[model samples]
Target: MQRYFVAPAQISGHTAVLEGDDARHLAQVMRARPGDKFIVCDGSGREALAKVVTVDKDIVRAEIVEERFAESEMAWRVTVAQSLPKGDKLETVIQKGTEAGAAVFLPFLSQRTVVQYDERKEAKRVERWRRIAKEAAEQSHRGVVPEVMAVSSWKSLIGRFAEYDLVLLCYEEEGRAGNGLRRVLTEFAAKQAEGGKPRILIVVGPEGGFDEREAEAAAAAGAKPIGLGKRILRTETAALYALACIAYASGELGGD
Candidate 1:
């Protein structure tokens, strides 16, 4: 069935309303009619199996036949704190990361970041990223769309580490004091098994990689420096790689 996310307030009692753009898409684009069934997600993990009851120029109303619990979400939440890469690379990170079970996205600037901040364009860029995440979530059948926060600084990254149950830095310096991602994740899974609602933050560096100071600060903030593998990866690739691996480790990718 087709799925559309509706605002929580739009759903009251057994009726769901799709307004504005969504309504136009249903009425004009999809040519939806009464009695057609579609899935409606509240974007907070609850969904309704609804049958269209009314379709007008400005709105589409559906009656809920059944309510659903969102089981597609991973057992734990994963957040990607990706350093702003050049061009549209950040959008790629948000899109694929959402599909791979990321709960949130954090775009930050590190010492090695190449993209300079533009206050005038920040809101627009963030909005684009969020739209990408929402579309990706729909495509991937995710329970909720991952949120993309506005650009932040290195200090903000450090200050937010304490908010997560496990924090990892995707670094390629194999010779440095570090553990492989597999080992680190395994240990965390075993040791922190009882940690309710696990929140993990995986930070990835930009194309030039993390400067010495950024790496040092990450370690001091209690983020384990972990390697993806021997080969170097682009910043966007690393973010998706980390999230995909976490999903498997937590049994979301496959049955244990």
Candidate 2:
């Protein structure tokens, strides 16, 4: 079924009005008509089966047939604090990271970061990244569209460590420990079992990796520096790897 996101105001009392871009896509792109059925999500995990009532040039009206809660969000919230990579790499991160069940994305600057974000174009860049996240979320059948936050400074990144129940920082300086992630995560969960669900923060550095001083500062601020194995990964790959490992260990992969 074709799926699109609808604004909260666009839907009311079993009726949904998809206008502007969605309207154009339905009329000109999908060529939908009255009685045609598709799925629409409100971007906050609410979804409905809607049937087209009218398809005008700039507005597409559909009556919602059914409404239910979406089940595609992760069992545990995982935030990825990724260092800004050069070129269009951040787009790839948001796209794939959303598919992997990340709850939020934070782009941060590190000592090794070389590409500078031009303030004049920051709005446009952030808009593009959010759009990529929306499309990826829809395609992945996700209930929620992961938020893409503005770029942060190194201090700001570390300062937010207290927000999560567990914080893991990928450090190349550490020796390879067998099954380190799984063991640490398991232990953390057991210790915090009395509390509510875990809110995890996984931080990955830029291409040149984290400076020793930065890693030390992060450790001091409640983040545990862990190794992603002996082999080195690119800045982009590190975030994906950590997210995948977390999902598998948490049984989000459907294993018993």
Candidate 3:
């Protein structure tokens, strides 16, 4: 079934009214008609099995047939704090990161970042990335669209690191023995086995990667510097790889 996201205000009782771009997509693009059924998520983790009641130019109305909690969200909350890379690599990061079950995407500017974004450009870039996330969420059958935060500096990100229960920093300088990501995941999994939710923050650097001072600063802020593996990957690749590893480690993927 086709999935659409609607705002909470538009949903009242067992009826939902979709407006703006979504309405256009349903009425004109998809040519949806009355009696057709689709899934509608309220972005608050509630999904309704809706049957189209009316299809108008400016509004699309659907009656909820059934409502249930969205199962597409991961049990663990994972946020990716990625330093801006050159070219359009950030778009790929946004798409794959959402599929890998990231709860939020944070784009940061690090010291070694070659691409620069001023205030105006930063706003536009963030909007574009957020759209990428939304499309990815829909494609991946996600319950809620992952949030893409406004671009920030590395300094500011580190300062806010205290909010997460676990923060993993993929630094190339770190070797496999003490700082490998797999080892960290193993240890983290062993630490707990029950109801409490895990909140994680994964940090990935730019194309040029981070300098020594920045790495040290992140370490001081309680982020564990972990190695991705023997082979080095691009900035965008690294973030996606880390997110995949996280999902697997968190048991989001099936296991015996």
Instruction: Locate the minimum summed-lDDT window of 10 residues in model 3.
Output: 174-183
lDDT of 2 by residue, 89-147 (tens): 88999999999999899998999988876879888998999999988988898888899
lDDT of 3 by residue, 140-162 (tens): 88999999999888889999899
TM-score of each: 0.95, 0.94, 0.96
Cα lDDT tens digits, model 1, 118-164, are: 88999999999998998888888887988889888899889999999
Give lDDT per model, in order. Answer: 0.87, 0.87, 0.87
Q: Which regions of candidate 3 are displaced past 4 Å?
A: 175-178
**Residue 47 in model 3: lDDT:** 86
Clashes of each: 0, 0, 0
Clashing residue pairs found in predicted model 2:
none
The global Cα lDDT (0 to 1) of model 3 is 0.87
Give the clashing residue pairs of candidate 1, or none.
Answer: none
